[model samples]
Target: MAAETSFANASRRPRPLTLVAIVLLHLAAIYGLARAFAPDAVASVEDSVLSTITVTVETKQFEPPPPPEPEPEPDAGEQGNEGRKAVPREVVAPEPRIVVKPAPPAPKASSTGAADTSGARDQGTGTGAGGTGTGTGSGNGGSGQGGGVATKPEWIGGRINNARDYPIPPGGRQARVGTEVVVKVTVGTDGRASDCSVFRPSPDAEADAITCRLVVQRLRFRPATDAAGNPVAAPFYWRQRWF
Candidate 1:
């Protein structure tokens, strides 16, 4: 009964050592919680974890793939006969033969004279003022054949006569005396100058242009004729000087 009493008393009153131990335990638990929640400790752990991770980005330099090699050309001899079929030969027509006709003879001229009126009958000959011929034509009775010859174009007025009335243009007045301009005039078969161009220009452009205009407008021509006496267009060259 006395031991029971003693145990009961101990149970009722807490021991100093036990109380101290309990208080120490509570303090240690609070310190541990504080350390766990500290910013510095969390930052340290994060830094350690981040420092261990390494991110590596590898870049590969890629050059464009080499251009494909060109295919070899086929041999000329081997491919020459490939995919070829026989073509029909075209029938060649014979060239036409050209026949040239001779020109007709020119008519003979007749003469008119007193002696040519004689009763003697001369067939192809004509007598002139006083000679031996069939007809009485002019000049000494020389039988003459008609002329069918080609002739060059002639200006209606002689070159000097045509240029006599040329007036100096207002623009050309400033140019020095004898400022020359050469021109080419194309004479048409109708005896008119159809086109003109300045072959050589003068100091004054207006003068050159006006010269061509006047040549084309005022100039007239006796058209050239071929051997058959057919009139043909021709070109005439002239030069004018400003005085």
Candidate 2:
């Protein structure tokens, strides 16, 4: 009875011999499956690596392009290719052109003598001549009136040359050629016409008219004053005509 119980327990406690053998068999099967299938799978993977075929068509070594052709030489007579300039006849120094910087108007040629009133100059009629210096100084075109300042004329008592003195052409409807007047009027001290008229006139009627209009519009003068500096009441003459 004791022997039978020990045998039963031994049987229940698995024996190592068969277990080890069974384990070794299972490992061998696994190793065989890995070996046989792994190589084939690796081959398939390697096939995927070489996706495209590179067929080399080796021919010959490459060569660069040929050099460009040289440019043609130029002819002697013609400049480069076209017409050439003629040689200068002689060397001439450039002239010294007097730019005249407008010369500040020559300081009005300081009158070493008294004012010349001979040519149609005023008679000093006590009407209202401005004064000895009746000329409007260099006009600045400013609209402001003078501040009791007196200005002298370039030629006192002298009548500015006018063109209206000539009789208009007496031909079919003789066009009334207005004067192109630049009257250098000399206003007397009496405010009356001492000496006044157009300065120059143009032979052309139209041109003369324009000048006359401009000069007339520009006429301005302080009435001639008496010795007391009072404005004289007289008609100052403004020569009117055209060159």
TM-score leader: 1
lDDT of 2 at 58: 15
TM-score of each: 0.33, 0.19
RMSD of 2: 49.5
- lDDT by residue for model 2 (35-79), tens: 687978756766686434222211111122444986974432211
Please identify model 1 stretches exceeding 4 Å from their true place. 1-149, 158-174
Per-residue error at 47 for model 2, in Å?
99
Output the TM-score of candidate 1.
0.33
**Model 2 quality (TM-score):** 0.19
- Per-candidate Cα lDDT values, in order, are 0.56, 0.41
> Which tens-of-lDDT digit does each residue in 190-232 have in candidate 1?
8887678877687777756766776676667788887788997
Stretches off by above 4 angstroms in model 2 are: 1-168, 204-243
Local error of candidate 2 at 189, Å? Answer: 1.5
Alpha carbon deviation, residue 173, candidate 2 (Å): 4.8
